[model samples]
Target: MWLSGAMATPIEDYALISDLHTGALVSRSGSVDWLCLPRFDSPSVFGALLGTEEHGRWLLAPDQPGARVLRRNYLESTFILQTRWRTDSGEVLVTDFMPVKDRRASVVRRVEGLSGTVLMRQELEVRFNYGTTVPWMRREAHNGKERLLCIAGPSAMVLTGGNIPHGSDHRHTGQFPVRAGETVDLELTWYPSHRETPEEVDIDEGLARTVAYWQDWAGLCVDRKRYRQPVRRSLLVLRALTHEDTGGIVAAPTMSLPEEFGGSRNWDYRYCWLRDAALTLEAMMTHGYDDEAAHWRNWLLRAVAGDPDDLQIMYAVDGGRELPERILPQFPGYAGSLPVRLGNGAVDQYQADVVGTVMVALSRMRDRGVDEDSFSWPLQRALLGFLERHLEDPDHGIWEVRGDPQFFTHSRVMMWAAFDRAARAARQDGMDGPVELWEALRDGLRTEILDRGFDAGRNTFVQCYGTVEADASLLQLPQVGFLDYDDPRMLGTVAFLERELLNGQGLLLRYRSGTGVDGLTPGENPFLACSFWLAEQYARTGRLAEAIRLMDQLVGYANEVGLLSEEYDTVDGRMAGNYPQAFSHLALVRAADAIHSAEAEQRLRSTQPAEPMESSP
Candidate 1:
């Protein structure tokens, strides 16, 4: 009953459901188009997000044509999704979720009829290894319950519930009728093929437990009066991206969603970037999640345990080091973007800003009363030694540009910040370290950046030394205390960015393409995070009204479920790139915090008595 040739759903139409170990993207049409099992970086079992339905997908919707989606939203403070649909014959509500803290990975879908009799259809295609392998499926009975067991090379899945689909030509299909007040439940569990089929889950217990888990976690967030809903949801999203066992936070779930539709700018984002993870930690700690900071710090120690010289920009969710880039010829690509990639090659590049980000985050943890431990402080000292060794090395920079390396201004500023934080920690926290050396290095780097990285005549900082082009990363200079937000130089740089990088719709681009800087095709939508950074800048620099306007506009881009992708195509008004991106969500949290702080300060000032006109001079 499902259409094999149906067009892929728009990126924004997908809502994320995660158990903190892995995630699935369920479309508005009730299709599970993307899901990686066992881990966030694992091969997907449902790969229709990148290719056609023939690849893989799970669909559960009304069999009747013209069944309209009335509304869909995540349950309060949780990833549990509820979608209501209405048809000529009847109405039905579908609830989808993944159980938290469960021993096994599974997805639960329950359909309840609300009105007259209605017919519903379920279709599933199981393809392992990113749609390259078809699984062996068989119908069997487990504990007197009918179930469908699917086994591939090493991965296996079992479908058990009130209704099971029949198989034909390696595809499963089923149709069932339900009347008002009737409910049908279906649960899918993934496990190793060598093991026995997983038992059917208790649908009622799982739902209740999942809801409670999310609500409890969300309740821990400190209350905010402004942008409360968005900030809370964004924090929940960051938590969802974090791996429960390893404490690794991924950049995004789905990969190879083109930054530019039908373009080749796509790359995998399932791995954990040190910079991204540190930033995520900072965002969490800013809102009273110090536990996450300590957890991720342990992950950091394990990841970079060996020689600090061997530090990489990113690693696998479990701290894997060997991530070789490869093209999947099987996937025709999302929207015809070519050479769908797996395993980021940038993992091997030297991104100078990574260690700096980690250090800044750890410094924040220390400030928040997370005392430095024996291993943690020693780790910081080791990282400082590594920076001392590579102090002058040109890096690929924060964007991981594929072109020739350069002394990127933003990276240099972050490097300065690393040493600045280290020296301050040594002097203030009484932590043992080479404080004098760190202070000297920090000051010298500051001098060099101001001399060469800045364009004196233009009064704006360049993307890298020996260039006039502005970069969005420069917007973060004030974030790390490299400069004051309202400094004339920073204001000039913001002006330059507004003129050069603002797209037609007033959103900020990372930088102008075609400058031979990134060494790729000249195309991509405005990166969502950069605009958020701009919002933070505006909020901090006395431009409260402008900041509020930009903040509202940026928040509006979140989908109906308050989820954001990596980029937004203003021309088409659709989200592009990886869905539910951690970078975007974390930046949103930071921006909202900045706006709230600014608003609070403004209120405080309004209540204060005037300065008595300086007593008439």
Candidate 2:
């Protein structure tokens, strides 16, 4: 029920629409609050999500006061969003989507009158370069159709439809009344300002083709009776975050959505992180999407196409490596969060776990019958060589802490996983490599971890070699096969995490920030991905009841259209951090798969007859 000129809406109120290049966040009240053109990391054209409406936004809703959202949901198996609004006079439906396979990037909003005549309003303020530059506006005829064109610097966008808005004071405004059975369609297209303006798209044809493409992709998922809807939706979110042409998957479509609202914990997540992308690939591969897995693998090969010693933990969507972090001070951040940032500084930091994550995912693909090309295997060997040279190097760890580097237990275990997977590939799959050396290195890591990482007195593994802290990332130990889920050490670590990291509402925090481990403020919401990892651990350990209860609670946090953010604020009961986060959704898919597997096992046990009782004397 948010209105224009008001403070930004909660993170959960936004739904995502993507066309495989860039994405736009549409608020529940019918506003495009955030949109980056050309690519995921491009500058924003609708930056109202992070600042005032004057920054930039597109508002399309009823012109009447108290016109509230009745309901909203995405069309089945697709990112097409349909929202129904009810005013005092009548009802209307708004459909929003970005057509796939289109030449120009565009957003299509179609409005249909469902009841009595209702008046609709349209307001657009296009600011390029993250809301810093207002575009030069003009009206021109393209293909005999009058369109409003806005050009600024290198970016240009055209607004075309039956009802073109009139501009005044750098804002476009229009109003029209629609009777029942009538419809109106508006399209916004972005292209290079230096090039010729693009033509108007065929809305009906684009819509049909987009729907078919998504449905066809979703049809490839393996059938799951339990948690099917959320799984399917989560899988689609992961796919939506992926760039089709480059095969690079971004962590999220957003930049600087605060992890802690009104705090300095915000960081950009628009780039492709190797760990997140590899995990996303594994999740998709588990559900019968090997083609996507191979595509991402090819992307990996292209991204790390140089000396492995220079490999970065993340890269741009097109594999560009120069990501310099900077702040935009002109625009106030989301909910007063300051210093909205662009680009990720963590690209320069060494995270030991990333190589292990990539190796494990590639190994999974190989096990699933994916043949590595000439370039892929050699690149992996070079990566192992780099790892061998940096075997004793301290790392910033998986959370990418800004604090001093340490030999994190999770990172070390993943290092072990890298060698283990390489050895397995060499021995079992006949992949050429130094299997003996890999085995020796793997064993050495295991011995060192057991000797230094574990706290035998507490029967738990510590966060690092010298710290006694329990990190929620420890829950992933069993995930990488570092230990059995039911191992005493893992159980002890889980119990410690529950006691130390769980908030009042039983959600998990990444770690105790008060320990200065992250070198930041001590307040933030519980990370959704960590909680999902806990759920997976519970299911794997035969705690089916607990796992289902936790899974239900976590899944319930998803917004109206089955989208989850990076974290959930249990105190305020709202989502925090970036919207439609790839990490959160991919972890949800894995957790659901674990729970489904546990449930099937439980059913099989129930169906089995008990063994005949022994009649011993």
Candidate 3:
């Protein structure tokens, strides 16, 4: 499915539209080059973004190749995309969105004439099985309406509209004219080939309902005095990546986008990682989406229902356990990044941070008035028991390092947090549990970390038990209650990270790849989440001006539509890694909230009388 000579559009030039179950990426030029069927991890029905239009694409644009894109934006907090195109003779508006209220899986594109007559062109190429199979297409009448039906091995797609493109060389092409005050609608739907073809839906009505659905959900966010728009947009993206029925949140919608283009760092993030989903739930709860938290907790229960020792780091959307990684040779990948990947091999690795992350999130949920039933409490106790079995084991760590396992400082700290939260829950929250045992475990781990994980000469915590390299993850020490924000040890660690991890543009990299710690190529962009964590740390330690400056610079990296990728290439000034990463956005919300809270506190202090200063002895 790799393009032979076609030049693919830049990743930044595309916008996303989703139906909650799946998403479609549309370039500004009005070509939908990437779309998955049934679910986020399903096979692509339109994958031209990874290849070319010849592989699969549905384009609706001005017939004039010189048409200029005037502007594009989502419809007021919703994923409904509106792009206006201007030609020398006239102008037109293309509205794209996936209907959410309906059961049918479809995408609707409506073209409206905004000015004088404009010639429009429609091209349809439906390639099934990741663009490796061209479907057999034919024109037919379905439900007394003319439609273009395409059939492949087990999947079928039908295109219903007034202007049916004629077949030409296994592709469909047509030209139509729309005068002022005219409109044309096109809808494409997917269904199993064995089942009856689904009926068409009213595109206008569906768009209205979808818009309301998103705005209503977004309206629930607690008002933020600063960065409200971007916060709202990030929340929307997280919702878009979540599976509505299953309550499983995906890290990103697309797979094999590459952490470093044309490098071997590519991975599939379509499945639900325990740590990522837990952090996402924490973000949602912070923004007043407690209902989502409850749902995801139930999903976790089902996903990890078996023996705690057998639990995986990730699971499928429906709570299935198996996710074997494999390479898709057919796809040339984004920007010639080869061997597109599906599933994830990291699921099998032991990431000790995962259980601690989940425990912390559940603690937050409890603090927010979520009553933990027997099911949840017992499950947590069992997870703690599982941790007890591996108290001194090495793990893959938070970054899922492919190298030999090590006793990562961050992972050990998180395990301490897990035991600490459990003890607090039982003693303070009046929850039933073994509090004394938990406290002893927590204290023992803390002493061990300070003794073995700290580099006393440098006054900094190292990446692992023996390494001298510092990790940006140390910025999270205050966040998880391992240490005070202004603790001298933490401040020293921050200084070391700023000196070693910051790129020339002052953005933070996850770690120095050249250290040979990750067991891969020695290059990657600055991780956006790590940078956000630094902003949060600054705010907590009373460095208000420094925090504000870094927060502003970090948010500016978001694309034009307010979506952030996992990493940013400071040198090249473009996004890297998976597009619209959940971790990046969640960290953004927390960082913005920190700044808002700090500003409010500062304002209140200025209005009140200061306490009398005590004389130093």
RMSD versus native structure for model 1: 1.6
- Tell me the tens digit of each residue's lDDT in model 3 across 340-456: 788899988999988899999999999999999879999999999989998989999999999889999999999999999999999889988889999999999999999999999
Which residues of candidate 1, in runs, are more than 4 Å off?
A: 1-7, 614-617
Ranking by lDDT: 1, 2, 3
Candidate 1 vs candidate 3: the lDDT winner is 1
| Local accuracy of candidate 1 as per-residue lDDT tens digits, 421-508 | 9999989989887899999999999999999999999999999999999899999999999989999999999999999999888899
| Candidate 3: residue 368 Cα off by (Å) | 0.8
Using all chains and alpha carbons, the TM-scores for the candidates as numbered come to 0.98, 0.98, 0.97
lDDT on C-alpha atoms for all candidate structures: 0.92, 0.91, 0.89
Lowest lDDT 10-mer window, candidate 1? 1-10
> After TM-score superposition, what is the CA distance of residue 600 in candidate 1 from its true location, in Å?
0.9
Alpha carbon deviation, residue 220, candidate 1 (Å): 0.3
Which residue pairs come into collision in candidate 1? Answer: none
RMSD of each: 1.6, 1.5, 2.0
